[model samples]
Each structure stands twice: as structure tokens, then as C-alpha cells.
Target: MSWQTWRTALISAAATALVVGLLTDTGQPTHPTTVAQASPPASGPGTNHAIDDPLTSERTRAWREDRFGMFIHFGVYSHLEGEYTRPDGTVCRDAEWIKRQCRIPQAEYERFAAEFNPAEFDAEAIARTAKEAGQRYIVITSKHHDGYALWPTKVNRWNLRDHSSFDKNRDILAELKAATERHGIKLGFYYSIWDWNDPDAVHPSTFGRYKERMYAQLKELVDNYQPSVFWFDGEWSTDRPSNPWLTQDGEALEAYVRTLDPKIVVNNRVGKRRLVDGDTGTPEQTIPAEPVSGQLWESCMTLNGSWGYAKWDNRWKSPADLTRNLISIAGRGGNYLLNVGPDARGRIPAESVDRLRAMGSWLVRNRQADAVHGAGTPGIVAEPDWGSVSRKGDTLYASVYRWPGAGGSLTLKALSGFDVRSARVLGSTQRVAVSRSGDTVTLTPSGAPTNDIATVIAIGVAPPAPAAIGTGTGLKAEFWANRKPGGTPTVTRTDPLVNYNWKYQGSPDPTILYSGFSGRWTGFVQPRFSERYTLTTLTSNTVRLWVDDKLVVDNWQDHGPLLSSVAVDLQAGKRHKIRLDFRKESNEAVAKLLWSSPNTPEQVIPTTQLYPA
Candidate 1:
């Protein structure tokens, strides 16, 4: 479906959760694990696990360990394959949601089901490719928003076996479930909570019966199909603009599904109002800046622009780019669910298979870094321009996407207090030169990378570096409690400046105003090297900042939650005076400072370089 359908359906809940950055290039859209070993680490509000239970949490950990998987967005829409023409003669982009976007009558949409004869579909072939691609699991659409079922459903006669040409030989879900089991790969089923095809799905009154039918269908799938994960969508399809009277009991339905198969991992879209808080956060087409440490999240992206088969769409990302994306997503400790759109023939596109095999080859060569367990969090060494860092145990895998130079040298900063024992390139026996100087480690490979996708250099070390805060002491502050920042002097104090998301019901200090307040801060900031630095500030009200008398950030507007930033060049070892003026217009006030540079990742400017002006 078009992203608009996704966004309008999900804008309310998804906007709050984190999305790992992966992009599906369809332009018109608004839309929208691991096996457990020991005690699994805590997950955020992304999963439905009752933290109170051990097995639930352990299942979640296992999901995280399965870092890579395949996402199949197949449906009757695949039959159209972007062949439908509009009045304007412009072909549609989102092949999956062609029915909704093009406003095809429900009857016409259903006809595609009869045309959808996936004779070439082989469950074993798909499973083998996914396994070879290093994917631990596979998620396929069982029933989409069109309400079409892939399995034999007593609730609806319009299912794969009865209506379509899919015979017992072409029963995909059953065969795939068995195939995946034989290959030791997990199987997931995608179910849309909303149904456009069900005739009784018109009003809230009719929704009850519709839901009953849905429950029956869901029960049948669980009782017989036995999927490991239940990926849900279209929960936002209730009582909104497009279909103003429609309703679905998303949460109740989810509860029922659990009674049948409680071990089934479900995505957050199972509920209407209470979204996310499900088993996993499914961020469609975008990878978040960093891992949501508290949440279980995955970035789902398309292989060639469209989610479903688009016969005309040829915009495919290079295997090199896709490989790097997999590493980046896994590095951040989030799962990567890449998609493939099958044709009417029920065959995965040749291009998609090639890309998956390329990734599989890379994973095979770098097996140590692609561990399903004990992987390190992302943000290792400020994300070198040459590539990224993925960790397994104490070894940091330098995934070199772009070789720094023929000289075979790369430097990593902020690796303090850790000793490097050895550095060797994976997939080859070549030893790399590893030297340390305090917090910096310089790696010199014997030569350039052999793999164009990614050549991993496993640098064995004694534990990894600690998470580094920004570089400077807290800024000096002056505050006026009852007034805005034109003049300030009611309070003055010192505190650490990193991670400054603050809230206070009463007084933060006796001297500073409890409600309306104005403040000014000044400090000296010096970079470790001569480079351009980007300074950022997120504030509730008006805020402006200057770097050495130059106004770098001017956000003095009566605004809500806002983030603003500016960039400036600075020489190393030379301290620059930084001044900030802030005014709290409301009862609650908060302000934070973040900075990034060639050597620094986006983090709060630390305390080591700060000095009172």
C-alpha cells in the first residue's frame, strides 16, 4: 500500500516509537532475535513480553539474536505487477496497495486473486535462499488488508484453495512452514487486522460479526499453521476518515490470538489505540539513528523500490549497499528484515535472489561478526567513514565498505582503556597492523579489501571502550526565575551538562524560578582536531547560542519541543567561548545540548573541555 495508507493508519502510534533508517523509494507515501541464552537483557516498550515472566523475555532475546530475515510482501496485487494504467497514463508505484490507491472496486480487486496463479512458487526454494542468505527467519503475508486468505479458511470461501488456482500443491503457508522447519529457520505470518473485503465491515455494529469471522480465521491459522511470529498491520483501519464507521477490536483480537498461541511473537500493530507495546517495533523503510536500547525494533525495506512485484520498477539498490545496511542495522542491535516481491508466477524476482545470495556470501565469509548472540551495540568509534563497526564478544568487526586508501590504514578514536590483542581480516589469512596511542587505535591492513560488499577485520581486544559522553565540563549558568532571558541573575550554579533532559514539578533550585524562567550559560569548548563542528540544542521554548561571538544557533521563538543546530569550523587545542540564552515560556522547561564533529559522534558536549567564561 502507499505510505499514505501506512502513515494515516499509524501516524498516531508509530510517531512515538523509534524507526531504524531504511528507505523504500516509492515517492507518494505518507505511511508510515536471538535465541535466549542467559537472562535476556531488558527490552523497551516495543515487545509484548510480560517482563514478569522468564520464558517470554527469553523468547524476545531469541528474536533479537536472529538479526537478519526475509520480508515477503506477496498478495493478489502481485498479479497486476504494475500493469494497471491510470487515466493520466501514469503507472502506479505501490503495487501492493494498488487496489486501495487506485480505488479499484472490491470486485475488481478480488478478481486479481483468480489471476494470481503462483505455479512457480516453491516453499523449499524460498526457504533455502533465505537460509543461504544468512536469514534466521522468514515473514510472509498470510492475509493482507484486502482480507484475502492464503490458507483454507472456513470463515471465508474466498481463499487461496477455493478461489484461486493455488491447489494443494500450491498451498504456500503450510508448505513454507514445513520447509522452514526442515531448514531450522523460523516462520512468521503477516496478518492484517483490518478487512476491506468483508462486506459486514462497514459500521461498528457490523464490526462485531466481522471480528468473529476474523477470530475464526486467526484460530484456524494458529491451530494448523503454527507460525512463530504474527506480524500485524492495518490496525489503524478503524473508524477514520476513509471508512468513518468501521471498527476492529485489535487488542481483544490480539488477546485471543495469544490464547491460541501465546508463544507467537506479535508486532505492535495488533491494537488500535494501544499500539507498539507489542512483541517488536516494525519500522517500515527507515532505520533509526541509534538502537532503541529499551525496545525491540526492526527496519523493513524493499529490494527494488516496491514492496510487491512491480514489473516496471527497476530501481534496485546495489548488493554492496544492501550488505552495508544489514551490517548497520545489526550493529545497532536491531534486526534487518529485507523484502522481496514475487511475481504472479510465485517466483522471487531474479534480482532479489542475486542480492540475497550476495549477502549470504558476505555473511559466510564473516561468520564471526554475524553471530546471532553476544553482539555489541552500535556507535563504535563514531562510525568511521571507511565503514562501520559490528561486535561479537570482545572483537570489533571493522566492516570496511569503502577502503580508506591503498595504504591500508584506518584510525579509531575514543577507544580508551582497552588493549588490542590482534587484528586480522576475515575471509582471508592476512594480518593487519594494530597499534594503540591512549584512546586512539590505528589499524593498518596488509592491503585493500578483497570483498566489494564488505570485508570485515576482526580486531580482538580486551573488552570494548566505555560509552563516551561529550567533551567538556557543564556550562556555567545564571537564571532568573520569574522573568525571561533579557536579563538574568536570580540563581547561579553548576551541574553536569550531558544528557540534560530535565523535568521538575517544584523548584529545581530555591534560587531559580519554579515556573517561568530565563537563563544564560557560558563556557569554553575546544575540539581535539581542526574540523567543522555541528552544535545542536533541543528546547521547550526560546533558545539562542553563540560560538566565540558568532551566533551559530538562533532559535528564539515561542515554540513547542524543537531541535536546532548550526555548524562552525574550529582549530584544535584552541578554546572557543560559547554562550547560550534560554527562556522558558511555560511552567515546564527543558534544554539539551548536543554536538558532532569529524571525531565526535552526535552526543552532548562533554565536561573535559568546558571552562567558565
Candidate 2:
């Protein structure tokens, strides 16, 4: 059924239940009907112990209480400002486009290493700003898809040190670690598993060898950094013909990381597909309507349009918007990792700083209402007009998003079952009157709140029960039309091709190519996809997918060089025409397509679903 139809059915079911509840009196006690009474608030020494266990609930509590944090996306790409430059210094169309797009040889692109200097970067300043802005932790990009290591690594010399001119020896990760430690803030790192520069890395055709290399590097990073959290990206490489590596060993990777440090929080990327160990990393600008149960989750978003420093991307969110988002996430028992992109000189944009400062001020006044032990109450519905409500021991904090219309009374159906000792607006100590009836608790304030945004109402209760998990099934994906026509019939050319290059205008745009070839060709595809995908190649040629659309995979990169069938989802009983569009060319060409699914236990094969092309 369609989403709209499902939603209508759900609404109808809820309305029916509400009517039934109102009609049945059945001599049931109006209040305190259950044999159990609310437990008294746990106090003092035991409070810490009660929260010591780092379960999903405890983590959610800690995150909600944090209220504010910082996100940093910095790497060699910062030097290019999202675009690459030619040898003579002409700015390429897609600067941060990746290595292959520049079409420069490996030696030439490596030449950029000499100029990769972030002279003005100050780790201490960044940490101090975050602390002052009321942030409790900081997450930075330790590495990106380009494969340039921000920290010193023994595995490869193509890191910040040997390749870059900027105090190449300095360790950015170590310095940031020390800075955050001194400032009493937790530190996390974003690591990309897919490497564009590493020929041994996973591409479309080579599965076994690539997995070995990928795991080795991950182990090295985890051992060295001991990061509080590991944000993994680039799990999918199936789209590019050059990428021969395709293996779903996420469970194994997660188990390995946990053995190293059980406390280390790993995102959903480490699991099959993008599923990580701890929680799903829902990108910024998107909020799930319902929460995911039996799993830890967080929403990572940017304060502005871009995650990295983009000079022209000035769209910034106000402090109020940021605070509302935080409260919403917390109310739903989730965390928000707000991000910021620093300039090449390593300076946090002034506008971002100002907005953070504003949030810091508001947090100070409302800290108690958001302390670490509080969890939201169950059976309470939040309306956009009314706002969110959270619960502490015996107190319920109702955060009003806007003033009520006409009457200023706040109503809650779950409150009728409990006795309210007192009610008061947060930031003020004055008590307000609260009345409880069969299934309704009404709070009448003496006066209007002074705050323009959200106002919190604290309701004193006897005690609280554990939170109830929301009901929702697993995730699913719906396939639409392909970007390329006739599936870009794979073609094989005997003549040597100088280079296979493709240009991507922006980050995160899906690009696909169709080719019909059968040969063992060897070349390097440089350009890489920002987000990883499962790579599938149709031909016998050792194919590897690289960002900048380079052919990093060849006969050597492919193990067994297995040819697997492809599948695509179409209307159950309908025919549709296929089209292929080749936007750019690459030196290393292989016929392949990238695909991902939101569902598990079911793999969609594109070739199997193919009709006459």
C-alpha cells in the first residue's frame, strides 16, 4: 500500500481506540488504579551507580544532557575548496572532485602533497570555542575518501607528513586529541574505509584481497587513535565498473572493533551495508518520524548547507533552530551531532562561532532541566503547536514550542493516572496549579512565559517507569529509474585507452555507467564516489572502481574475478525502457553499476531484472 494510505489507516485506528477508552467507565478507579505506585526518586550516591551502566537508555540520557557538541570536517580536500587545480594552477571545474577527475597522472596529483599545508590551524582554539559554546564533545574527520591521512601512519607514506608541505611532520589528530583532553571534551573520528589512492583497496571485482587490506588499515586506526567513536563511510562501491571488491563483512568488523574497546562507539556503517555497531548515523536535514528500537542511534547534521568549508554555501541555521532540533532529538531519546566546516587556514567561520555562542548562553540557563539522568515519559504525544515533554525522576519537563491558542492550559492524557505535587516553568521557581481527572492532567500557568522560543514545564510526580520502545519494522528501499540509457551497453576496445575520466559537479550526486566488455584490462580509475557503494562489473577484465572515476582495479586487484548476475526492481507486471548516460570518461573503464538497499536479508540483482536493452 502507498504511504499515504497506511498513514490514514493508522490515524483511524488511533481515533477508534480513543473513543473506546472514553466510553468504558466499568467502575475502574479514576486515579492510582494499578496495584503499583510510583517509586520514590533515587537520590545521592546511588544516582551515579544507577546511570553507570552504558546501556542504550543511559547513552541516550548522556547525549540528551550534553545538549551541545561540535562537528568538524577537515582534511586535504580543504586545500582544494571542493575543486582540484592543474599543474600550472588553473582551477578545475570540480575542485574537490577527486583524483581521477583532474585526469592528472598519479605523480602529478601527488604533487599536491607539496602544497598541502594548513598553516593557521589551531586545535586548542577550536576546542576552546566548542567548550565555551557549551559543547561536550567534538567529532572530526581524521580521513576522507581521497586516502590522505591527517595523522602519521606506518602503512603508507602518502599521508599528511611525506606528501604535504605544511609542517608535514605535525600530527593533526594527536594535537586535536590533546586539545580536547585538556578542555574535558570527548573526541571522535570519521574514517573512510574506501581508499581512492590505494590500489590494494577494494574495488568492484576483487573481493578477498581488498577485504584484507581494508581490515588491516582499520585495525591500525583503531589501535592508534582509541577514538571515543568511529564514524565509518564508503561501504558501497558496486556502481563503478572498475571496483571489483564486494564483500559484506560488517559484522566481523564490528566484532573486531568491540574486542579492542567495548566502550568505543561505532556507527551503523560498520555493519552490513551502512549498519554500524552502536547507532544509525542519520544524516543532517533528515529526521526519522519514529525512533528505532533495540538500537542506538544519532542524527549527524551540519549547521549550514555544507559539511566541509564551502565559501559560497552561506546557508546557516539560527541558534533557535539548532536548539529546537536538539530538544526534538532528545525528546525522542536520540542525539544530534551538529557539524561545522573550517576554512583552509583552519579557522572556524565567524558566523558559526556566533551561533554556537548563542546556544551556549541558553544552555546555561536550562542545564538542570537537561541533566544526564532524565528520560522522556511514555504515552505523551507532542504536537508542533505545543512542543516536547521529557521526564526526570518525579518531574516531567514539558517544553513548549509555542504559546497555546486562546486558553493557556496544557493538557496531557497520561497525567490523569498520577498525582502531581507541583508544576513550574523552567528558569523560574514559582509553582503553578495542576489538576488531574480520569485521563487528563491540565496545567494552568499564572502568567505568560517571557521566552519567545521553547519554554519548559516541570511537573513533579511520585516516580517513573522505564521508557517504552517505539514500534517500527526494519528499513526498506524503493527503486526508481536509472540515470543511464540502454544501460550504457558495455563495449570492449582493443586499442589502449590513455585515461578513463568522469567529472562530478558536487558531492553525493549519484553517477552510473553501462558498458559491455570482456577482457583483462589493467589501468587506474582515479575519481572516487564520495559515499561508497557496492561495485559490480560485467566483464572479465580486472575492474576496480576509484573516485574521480579512476581505474584503480585491474586483473591484479580482482580475486577470482567472479562474474555475478545483476538485478533491478521494476513494476510487478509492466515493461519499462532502459537508458544509459555516460557523463564523463575514465582511463580505466569497466562495465558496472552501483546499488544499495535500505533492507536486509534480501539482495536486489540488477542484471536479473534486465529486459531487452
Show how many residue pairs clash in every candidate, following the order shown. 38, 83
| Model 1 Cα shift for residue 542 (angstroms) | 24
Instruction: Please report the TM-score between candidate 1 and the true structure.
Output: 0.66
In angstroms, give how far residue 178 of model 2 lies from its true place.
1.1
* The candidate that achieves the highest lDDT relative to the unseen native structure: 1
lDDT of 2 by residue, 207-296 (tens): 445455555555656777667777776555432213332332554455456556666667666643322133445444565564433234
C-alpha lDDT values of all predictions: 0.66, 0.50
Over the stretch 1-613, how does candidate 1's per-residue lDDT look in tens digits? 4335455533443121111111113221111111112221222211222321211256566677788889998888888885666557865445776666565544455556666788888899999999988888999998887667788776655567766666654678889999999999999888876666665555665555666676677777888878888887776643321232221244355556667777777776765322123557777777877654323678888887878898888999998888888888877667889999989888999999999998888777757435333454533355677777866667677887777676657888753345778888877777688887866779988776777877788877764333333355567777676546555477676645623322323233544544566778788877665567778776666888899898878877787646677878876677888888877676335566667653444455666766666
- Best candidate, TM-score-wise? 1
